[model samples]
Target: MPKLSNDKNSVCSLAQKQCCIRSLNSIRCDSGVTSAKAGRSCEGDDGNSCMDDSYQVCCSCCALGLWMRRQGQGCDADLHLGPSCGHVFLTCCEEVEARSQLPLRGQENLKPTVLPRRGNGLCSQRCSTAGGRVLCSCFPGFFLMKDGHTCEGEAQYYVDECAMRKDRCGKDFLCENTPGSFKCIPKQKCLSGFTQDAHGNCVDINECSSLAQPCSSSFACVNTVGSFNCQQKVLVCNRGYHTSPDGASCADVDECQMGSHACGVGQICHNLPGSYRCDCQTGYQFDALRKVCTDVNECWSYPGRLCAQTCENTVGSYLCTCTAGFILASDQKNCEDINECDQKPCSQECVNMHGSYQCYCRQGYYLHEDGLTCEDIDECSQSIGKLCAFQCVNVVGSYLCACPPHGYVMSANGHTCTDVDECKVGSHNCSSEKTCFNLQGGFRCLSFDCPHNYKKVSSTYCERINCAPNSFDCQNSPLRITYYTLSFQSNILTPAQIFRMGPSPVYAGDHVIISITSGNEENYFSTRKLNSFTGAVYIQRKVREPKDFLIEVEMKLLRRGTVTSFLARLYVFFTPSSI
Candidate 1:
């Protein structure tokens, strides 16, 4: 490559100008340059000098820098200078007036002169001119080399406009880098049911309104997110034939199969073409108004023909029942008597009757309050009179009359009691000195003796002996003493006169005072004066049990001014009331 001086005057000199013209025929220009006047000298006082207005001067390679200086610009080394003066010039100058007006051709034969830089020619990737200077650039992924003309780097080595803050996207836009370039994308992206507007906003899309006839004529269309749906239409049909689900046609409905008929529990349902019928079961009747089955009461319908004794109604049947004491016969309608005696309901004896039984007791037994068991009859407690003269002993079924162990005997009647003569029968235990006396139910021995001043007058009486004139004992002693015995039952009434005492011969002027002196400690016996001479001894209190008493009765007689006393020894006995 030929070199040019930095001095513009030397680059535009005549010698350098001639030398550029010789080289111009073989050089090529990549860009166009302006023409100048013909026959003009290449020399000028100012540094901005050029050749004449001709094609030779415009196509010359040396006059490239002169034209630039004349155009008030500077030369860059990276620019290409062709051989003809019509190409971009950098160093020499020349002129050809008419040739400058014609279009230049034959650039393949023209030789190109590039400044000393890295690259095959002006640039490896891109080349341009700006501000009167040649610029070399690379694609987005590459960078300019140190030579200022070549591009270096691979596809992976790129400039991130986003990270480097070199993108022209606004706040609403996102910067996306590509292999050799970058793009501005909207940040707000539209979803399935929406679309993006000019302002980059997401707006809803009315698919229902926008789409043409999306649903069939029988269905209504409904819109959804990113989709649509079809719904069935409503329609009415005639009776028994209902409309289909799609509302396109009508079909028959089976009332019996669908359980929609008005048949009762015991009725059966049958389906027809468009209607239904209900039938009653056996022994039942159908009611037209209620459409239900009713049962037939056979007992009420047949009355006496159903049963002999009684009739009862049952569901779909009848029943026959007998009275309390009767049972139904094998014929199921007639009644038969029940034999109550077979059950042995009575403890003693049971007699069967037509419909019941009677209870009877044995000879000595009677019926108890319960009417079933027999109990012993207490004759001893029930008899109003004395059934036995002595003690009546009650046995299981009868009573027995008992006599005293020694002094009484049971009579031949077996219920009467008799007194035994112990003296004559030799059953008494009396000594030789005592006399045996018999009573109703017992016996007692009696003996009387005189005192020293008295003499016995009889077996029961004693008298005092005569006294001398000075005998005081004889004067005061009893003139007579008598012994007596009495017997009675313990049921004897009180205040009974049991004994009486008086002088054997009645005297006109005799007054006696009588008293019981001993053996009356329980106050059971008392003495009373009657007519001043006769006095009686009476039993005052009744004895409820058998007892014996020996009482002494004393009497003082005041007659003719001489006092005389008498004594009576009385024996009283109380026998048992029943014996």
Candidate 2:
């Protein structure tokens, strides 16, 4: 009842004129705000502000707000409706300024414009009647029809697999899925003192099976995912056993008996049962405590027992072994006897005894007379293999193992049988001093000749010739006979005494002892280095050329005794200056 105005379309013709006036005055034209304020704004009323009562104000250009409206376009300018009605197209300058604002509503008769947003696609999800069909809705108080087009008491996820029984659901309600359909599921449990038969009908579980849950302290029972559980209590010994009294109390058990303890080597025993197990004694261990039977090294008591050779712990026990030369003992506590002899006894023989063995030689053989050795003996007469002779010398425990005849003898190195050169292969060699002439069993190299620059003083030695002119004439000199006073001696004595003659170079001379201080004693006789004898003196050696002796004397060599002990070892060396 305030006021009324009309002729809205006619304003389009006036728009250019109104815009020109705005430019001339540098003022703004506001069809929206100015219309709302003046209620009918008259742009050229000079200073008078005017308003039209029949026009609608608009705010945006994006929602088709700039388009003019037709009377039958579901809207009437008489009432002014719809989001986009009659707003002028904003120019570039105005759009730049209005860009910060939200899309504007231009008509009041438009349904309450809900600016849901592009991403949500609100229009697509909203249900509406389409193609002669209406969408379903869960209304406040209506039961539903067979299709989703009607509301029901309650809705449920329907299973399409049982579509055969589409409209009606039976007793049990199972969920199902379908495009615009659902079904009811049934109940499988009862609240009352009710019971269900087979076929998955509601029933009661037998709690009497203890299924509801029942057990003592040493036992356990757990409810299952859908049921219950029951377990037996673990049994234990009363005072000293793994078994209970009435066979019923759970008590501490002594694991030391019943052979339950699988102790290792050097370990004592223990036992357990029922809810029982084994354990090693003091210095041993249960491998995992899981099975007390399995023992391992605690090694606290017997230090070296574990690694005597290398003791390795095993499942039920540890083992004690010996080092290469040692063995496990009977008590199993210490290392004991091992037979090194069984493996190698020096060489030829092996004998094993408690802790050791002794080596011995066999017949036709002799130990080297040294505890460390064994030597072959010669038993030629007893056994041809011993020596190559009819006579066999048995010495000590065995005969000589030698090759003696046929000009051959055992070599100095013992084992080798070497050929005798008659000069080099025999026990005694009469070499250049004697004669190298081959003989029966061996050979003889005997030389009785006087050496150069020396005259034969005795059969075993020579002397330098020096005398007053015409003292005595040798066989090769002038024929003159003369006597000589001789002095000869020997510092050493041999097992066999021999004869010695000296001080005379030829047979034409005779010898005599001037004096003696009991010449019977060996040391007294050789005092002046004078010759003494214990064996009969043979004539001066005269065989061959330049014999060792041509002396004129007589003496004897005792066959029974010889001197051995001596203070100084003297070497009586004589070189022949002439012979």
Top model number, lDDT: 1
lDDT of 1 at 518: 91
Q: Where's the lowest-lDDT run of ten residues in candidate 1?
A: 44-53
* Candidate 1, number of clashes: 28
Candidate 1 per-residue lDDT, tens place, 304-403, comes to 6878767887776778887656788899987766778788888876644333455655333566778678786555588745466666788889888888
lDDT of each: 0.62, 0.34
For candidate 2, the TM-score is 0.17
**Can you give the lDDT of residue 413 in candidate 2?**
48
Cα lDDT for residue 139, model 1?
Answer: 38
lDDT tens per residue, model 2, 178-205: 4334545565566553455757566544
Candidate 1 regions off by >4 Å?
1-386, 394-398
